[model samples]
Target: MAVRHRLIRTSPRSVWAVLADGTRYAEWVVGTASSRPVRGHWPELGSAIGFEVRLGPVSLSNETVVRRCEPGEALELEAKAGPLGTARISIELRPWGDQCLVLVDEHPLRGAGGTLHNVAVEALIQIRHRTMLARLAKICETEAAEAEQRRPLGQVVSPHPDEGGPRA
Candidate 1:
């Protein structure tokens, strides 16, 4: 099993927003080059997203299915990496002050990765998790910063600028 955690300087809703967007997978998930919704609605149980993992001239076709979702709380996924088999990944979000603590737990469920699971592989997974979590944090922080910019003075405005707010 590979487990890792990261503290994001943003709300759980912000982190979950990133997770909920299937197109953003490549932005945070290491090795993923691109992603697209494949079936149902992403982050909903039974929904899936297709992604490409590129390494040099090699590209692996993959897909991940949502196994569980708890809105701002947690999300569980099952990733299918073709010949590498599949992996079960669970992400939990806890509110910490004004920020969020995210935990990722992963383990191989089948195929070559499962057959060869060991300390060495676990170490590699740890590295991947470290990088992945960092990427997620960066994205969420950037999103928070951008959100701040959109609504200056920390005032929440109508998402649609066309709608006036309380007669200015």
Candidate 2:
């Protein structure tokens, strides 16, 4: 398994707001160039998103299904990448100080990826997870900042116990 964690300077609900938006899938997910809802309501178990991954001149279509969802807490997905088979990706959100600690756990479940799973593959996954988690944090922080800006300067918004202070 490839596991990684990131501290996002946003409340769990703020982080979840990004995750719950199906249209933002490509913005944070590594390698995904674009994403669209394919079936059902996104974030709901069994709902799916179709995404395209581009590598130079080649573009591949992949589909990911929501395997499990716990509002504001967790989401688990199964991503199918053609001959690469499928991978299980589980994301958990934990409240820490006023912020959200996001944990990602991923593993190859089937296909060539599963058969070839090894330490080298895990190392690559770790690298990818690092980038993905950073992107997610950036997106969440940016969105939260934008939302805060929309509010009046003196209007206080309740801070999440985990998020600490204002994000920079």
Candidate 3:
């Protein structure tokens, strides 16, 4: 099993927003070249997303199905990697002040992956999780910053525009 956590400088809502958009998975998930919703609605239980993983000229097709979901709190998935077998991935979100702490847990459930699982595999998964969480954090933080910049001014207008409050 591989377990890792990351502290994202954004609200859980923002992180969940990214997760809820299945098409965005490739942007944050390690090794996923592209992703698209294949069945039902992504992140919803039983819904699945198809993704292609490319390594140089070689490409492998895989699909991940949502096994469980708790809206902004948690998401559990079963990722099928053809003959390599399947793995269970669980993601949890916890509120830390105004920020979000994301935890990821994964383990091989069946197939060759499970049969061949060992310390080296666990280490590899740890590295993947570390990179994946960093990618997710970057996306969420950047999105939050962009959203802040785009937000309309509050009701209170500043007497001087240079003061940085809402312009009169």
Candidate 4:
């Protein structure tokens, strides 16, 4: 298993918003390009999104299906990458002060990936997770900042609606 965590300078709701948006998958998910919703509403249980993976001159279509979803909390997905096999990915968001602690856990579940899983694959996943988590953080932080900039100076918008307004 490859597990990594990042503390994003934004609310969990903010992080969830990014995860909930299927169109943003390629932005934060390493190596994927042009993500789009394919079946159902993304992030909902059983929903799926399709994306293209490019390896040099080869381009393949991969699909990720949501297996479980706890809004504003966690998302569990199964990513099918053609013959390379499927991988299980889990993302969890926990509120920390005014920010969000995001955790990502991934492992090969089936196909070539499962058969070839080893220390090298684990190491590569770790590196990919690092890049993926950083990208996620940057998106959440930048979006939060932009939202703040657009808000009236004298007003405060509660990023976490379930947690009430303003943080001391």
Candidate 5:
């Protein structure tokens, strides 16, 4: 498994807003070039999103289903990547002061990816997770900034009061 965490300068609700949007799936998920809603409602258990991956001139479509959701706390998904098989991706949101600590855990579940899982594969997944988490943070920050701008003056934006410091 590959696991990584990022400190998002936003509330968990703000972070979850992005995760709940099916259109934004490709924006932060590694390897996906585009995403669209496929079945059920996004972020709900059993909901699915269709994603396209482009490699040079070749493109492939993959489907991902939401396996579990815990509102602002957690989301787990299973993605089927054609010949490469499937992977389980889980995201956990922890309150850190006034901000959110987002943790991502990913592992291969089926097909060649599961069969060939190793240190090298884990290293690659780590790299992907690093990029994905950074992207997620960026998206959350942008949304948070927009949300702050929309708030009335003197309003406490985040639910957590101590969100101004770095997260562990």
Candidate 6:
């Protein structure tokens, strides 16, 4: 198994918002050239997203299904990589001060990838996780900053509904 973590300078809710959007999969997921919802509602258990990977003249397609979800807390998925097999990916978010600490754990579950899993493959997964987490952090932080910029200087918007309305 390969596990990696990153500190996103934003709330877990902010990070979850990005993860919950199926269309945004390619934005932060490394190697995914394009993606779309293929079944059910994304981020919900049993929901799936179909994505394509382009490598110069070659293009390959695959799908990822949500196995478990805990709203803003956790999401576990099974990513099917054609004949190479499927992998289990688990993402967990923890509150850290005003930011969120995201942890990703991945391992091959079936197929050729599973049969060939070794140290080199683990290293590659680690590298991919590092870049993937960085992309996620950049997205969450950038969006949070942009949202703050759009609000009035003296205005305050509550992240939760029960907190009250946007106030100035």
lDDT of each: 0.91, 0.92, 0.93, 0.92, 0.90, 0.95
CA RMSD, predictions in order: 4.1, 3.8, 5.7, 2.1, 4.8, 1.4
Q: Which is the winner by lDDT between candidate 4 and candidate 6?
A: 6
- What's the C-alpha lDDT at position 150 in model 4? 80
In Å, residue 59's CA in model 5 sits off its true spot by: 0.6
Q: Provide the TM-score for each candidate, comma-separated.
A: 0.90, 0.92, 0.90, 0.94, 0.90, 0.95
Model 5 segments more than 4 A misplaced: 154-168
Off by over 4 Å in 3: 155-168
Number of clashes found in candidate 6: 0
Error of 6 at 164 (Å): 2.9
Candidate 3 lDDT, 1-168, residue by residue in tens:
899999999889889999999999999999999999999988899999999999999999889999999999999999999998999999999989878999999999989999999999999999999999999999999998997777676655443435895653
Backbone clashes in model 4: 0
Considering every candidate listed, which one attains the maximal TM-score?
6
Which portions of model 1 miss their true places by more than 4 Å? Answer: 154-168
lDDT of 6 at 156: 73
- lDDT tens digits by residue: candidate 4, 10-99: 989889999999999999999997799999998899999999988899899979999999999999999998888999999999989988
TM-score of 5: 0.90
Candidate 1 worst ten-residue window by lDDT:
159-168
Ten consecutive residues with minimal summed lDDT in candidate 5?
159-168
Supply the TM-score for candidate 1: 0.90
Residue pairs in steric clash, candidate 4?
Answer: none
lDDT by residue for model 2 (1-168), tens: 999999999889989988998888899898999999999999999999999999999999989999999999999999999999999999999999889999999999989999999999999999999999999999899988899889776766657435654443
Clash pairs detected, candidate 6: none
Between prediction 3 and prediction 6, which has the larger lDDT?
A: 6
lDDT for position 168 in model 4: 38
